[model samples]
Target chain A: MPLMTSLHSEASSMEFPALQAVSTEVERATVDRARAGDQQALADIYDWYMPRVYRYAVARVGNTHEAEDLTEEVFLKLLSAICDFKWRDVPFSSWVFRIAHNCIVTHYRRTAQRGGPTSEIPLDMIDGRHDIAYAIEEQITMEEVRVAAAQLPEAQREVIALRFAVGLSIAETAKALGKREGNVKALQHKAVAKLQKMLIPVDGK
Target chain B: MTEFEQRLSECLEALVQGRLSVDECLEMHPQHADALRPHLIAATAFARTADQQPSAEWATTARQRFLIASGKSLQEAMDIEPEPTFFASARVRFLLAAQKLRQERSTAKPRRVPLFGTPMRAVGALAASVALFVGFSGYTVQSADAALPGDWRYPIKLQTERVRLAVALSADQKRDVQFDIAEERLQEIEALAYKGKIIGPGVLNRFVEQTQPLVEQANDGNLDAGDAARLQQVSIRGTQVLDQVEPQVAAGAETELAQAKVISDTGVTVTRELVVKNPDRPNIVITPQIPVSTATPEPTEAIPTDEPGAETPTPEPTDVPATEDPEATPTEITPGEVPTDSVVMSELPIVEIDDIKLHTLTAGRLTLRAPGPSTGWYLDGVPESGVPLLVTMKTQNQQSFIVLNTQNGDMYWYVSAASNNRFDEIQMRLTRDGQVFQADAAVLRYFYGDAAEIPLLVMNSIRILPEASPTPEPTATLESEPTPPL
Candidate 1:
């Protein structure tokens, strides 16, 4: 039985690389160090996570320059805020993205108060992929939808953005927004009704 | 909501997702036309906006301007707004005045050139001399083949002058040579920046402009060395700008290395001082963690005492009881010790080794589990598999053992040399405080040699007495009764 077990171990060992286990150990140690408020560890996390955040911000903000500024500002805020963050129920990725979402919403709110319509979506910063032309075309329609959405009550716009742009589920959206799931659903329905009335031309011309 | 509104909302969702059928879009009635019209127009406006790519340059420029305008009043910043009208008003007066001046210039045109030409040519000659100096410097470094750190700056200077001269030069035979020289200098500057020796914003900006075409060309992926050199130039230029402004950008590395060296050198000195200063922080109240035993009974707590001369105050364990084992038992009682009280332990089972796999972990905690009658396990004297056990490791003589336990997974054995009765348990097992561990295979292999195999049932028995004597006995007989703590 021992010989059979040894043989089985040998076979399975050949299939799994020992280095994979080592990497996981290293990653866990690094994450733990980061959680302990090691500045270097936090910086490393920033270095790895920045490019993705920058790209996402650029896609949303529609200007490379603003996105770059926003990325730096977001990271700066994250550095100060993360120390006090008690990650109770959400995944770390979700927490980071929530920070990003808050930053974007705050920026829009600030800009809106300054009297410019917060509608110019920065499509130019997106990577020029093969289907970029099609993506742009679709993006224009989405922007229009967003504009029509802007005409809806603020409650509806929040629900739609949370649902579509952030890809949060109804329950997750509710949790994030601190609203009931039913309220979110009703707002979503009302928002959609208003959007259709705004979008579909009554004259059909 | 009306039926039309519901249908329209569904269609809009589909539309936003790029899944709307043409038929579905056409199905909207005239009453909903106001909303549908804008959507259609906005959707079709894509063709016009397709080529309008967003660039960061404008935003960066705006931000820089905003920074500069920081102290200015709102009215002062708005000063540029009314400038268009100001210019319009000035234009009327200037046009009438310029007509009179033109008539005067026509009369004085021939005489003015001699005055203008001498000074203008002198300035142009001075610029040409500076350009030649820059060109010569660049060529001298390039021919030597040893890279000059400041060579890129010379080409940038030469290129700037070349641009000026190219604009100033008349249609002459030397015009093409001027253009070629300008282009060559631009390329050379790009190459210098690409190599990372050259630094600065003015020089870097020149390199960025030179490499712009190559960057566009490299979008096709079959970029030649020249194109790669150009892209490298732009990236290096970006880094150079960053380096100049923010020297702390690479804060982790150089500072960390310096601090680490300091810490290593002052290791014992710093430690001794910290201990002398805030002695309270290091003072640990370590209750000798009770080992899990096979004879399941009504759980009792044990108040552990401090070992030897450790500075930590050993708080009396709350509500512990005397050992109830009938076999070997603890002989000495530290008199006057507070009697430990009993409290029903709450099952706040913390997930030990969460966000991680316990068995494979080397740096984080490793969870050990005992082979069970059912599958639930225990840690300490408690029955809770999910309790998050604090993971810690000890390294001695170049070998490292990661020791930790959540409820079900507990390591309770020792290495062969640590045991006193070696003959009783032939293969040394890991110990939790002092008990035979029947944790998983990974724990067994990690604690003992790879050849070690633990018995399924008897392995979970306590080994309270140190294994000093090699008592020759069958494992079944040795593990029949719980060994009391000596």
Candidate 2:
């Protein structure tokens, strides 16, 4: 199918690498130790997952301060609820992302109660790199994509965030969202199509 | 799924797995290529855009906070002592001794000793209890003495007050203890307000519960001269503290603060009258002059002003007798003339819904705008035991219902579409006396949209009437009928 050849051009330009699946044995051991109240294991889990959680939070909330607060709240909730975590088919990462997802939902609800605006793409997310022109181009693209993504329906937006932003597999996304894998696939397809229609004109320009 | 959707999902997965490019996927399925290209590009762009990294400094600080929080969690799980070094050591020793006794009982021969089988163990348990009591009485109580709301020691302080009240034998003794506790609550409120902390409804409720009885006693002339004098001192102190702290109180707690201010003002008025009746009473010494600027007049003004000689000179808390001639009649200070401060209920405009006037409805000390018959909102009926005045109101579409506790000021707005469980709905702490009310955004946006202002207006129109009344019964029973739609 020449899939590898076609993928290479797009893959080579990819600035943010996709999340690699953690080795099941290693993750299981760490999770088990954490469940046993091992502080080091918990710290290890936090160190490994904090950035991913922060990225997910930023994508969902679109503000650094709120994201930071949500990130901290997620970790604290994990600390309290981890003991009740049963080792099931669901991966630990999915469990952690679920916590982050719920926190974002609550954050949105709270913001709504305050009658405040939700999700403004933070300008500071644009990196100040040596290549000024490239940096500006990259910054503009990200902002445009984020602004478009924010317009997606809540379910579709969440699906795209977990699938593309957090790099969760379709199955993992389903587990985290408490949805069927088929539902996740349908939501992702709809989200991607909507984003395409919204941004295609902008991209052509 | 549509053939195109299936093809897109497959290609998207392959691309996400980093094994297939957008062009390659389209090349493999040329029929779907035109439709797939833009979607693939959008997905890729979003993936790149959403991949955000927090600043290094923030990450470092966040990690530090996470670790600290995790440590505290671990300490709590392990049940580590939060006491001083001495108490911690004593507690550790006590736990160790208990553990040793448990081990000894498990390992030693299974034999009962004397009337109390395991006499040593019983003695150990007794010793532990004694130690706990001693430790609590000595250190915990001393520390809790200064504890404010939200402090870990605050519950202990409340427990100790309950203990003091429980131990008092006579009615007068209990009343005295109640007065002391009431003063303590005022002090806690002052301390919290001074630090710009929120005075929650719980503290305000307790303060009213404690002081209301004593205020009533003085009003009814049931209190002895000594008790009346003490009531006067407390009322004065309460007035001074509330006035000083009024500006410092946080925004949401204003209703509770206003209610408390009314109680204090009422106490001041009632006690001053008692003093007037017994002018020669040794305890009728000087009471601090209330600054007219800070004195709220709602409570006093609400009383009928029909008496010819109602206005009296403000009583100065001095040692001088009330009258120059001991034989001469004392100047009477009528109850109606006592200056008091509260949110004036009369100022609230009468709201008419569907041509039905919503007049002020009084229940105990609480007065609110009674929901009009045609307003869709109904007074579901106050529980026979008059607290929390739960008035359930349904929206026009019957999609949501709000359960408002008009007494303690908790408003629970529930959307039927959200969850069946009421707890999942938006629960807002309305200001006591109904000064400020806010609606949750999710409920408003998802359901009400442009009509969000309807709920806010209804809530704002409701007012808490601050008339001095006896304490309400504690329990509540909700009405059975489901509220109808607006």
Say what the RMSD of model 2 is: 24.7
Tens digits of per-residue lDDT for model 1 on A138-187? 45554555456557676676665544443345665676666787787678
Candidate number of the best DockQ: 2
Candidate 2 wrongly placed segments (more than 4 Å)? A1-12, A201-205, B1-7, B15-35, B82-486
TM-score of chain B of 1: 0.17
lDDT of each: 0.38, 0.62
Q: What's the distance in Å from true for residue A142, model 2?
A: 2.3
- How do the residues B46-144 of candidate 1 rate in per-residue lDDT, one tens digit apiece? 211222233456434323222111111111111223334433322222222222323343465545456566556545533543443231222332232
lDDT of 2 by residue, B1-486 (tens): 999999988887777666776667878999987777778878887776656677887787666545444443444333345446535333343333333434454456465555555657656754654454232123443466689999876755665565456435468877888888999988898888878886666777678888999998888888987888788788878878888877766677678778888888888777755653464443211111212121212555544444434233122223321222211211232233222222112222244443433433433333344343345454454454545446566645565566765454345655443232222255443443324434443334322343334344344333333344323335432344556788
Kindly provide the TM-score of model 1 when superposed on the true structure, using C-alpha atoms. 0.26
lDDT of 1 at A76: 50
Candidate 1, residue A107: the lDDT equals: 78
Model 1 chain B worst lDDT run, 10 consecutive residues: B356-365
RMSD of 1: 34.4
What lDDT score is found at residue B330 in candidate 2?
Answer: 17
- Lowest-sum lDDT 10-residue window in model 2 chain B: B283-292
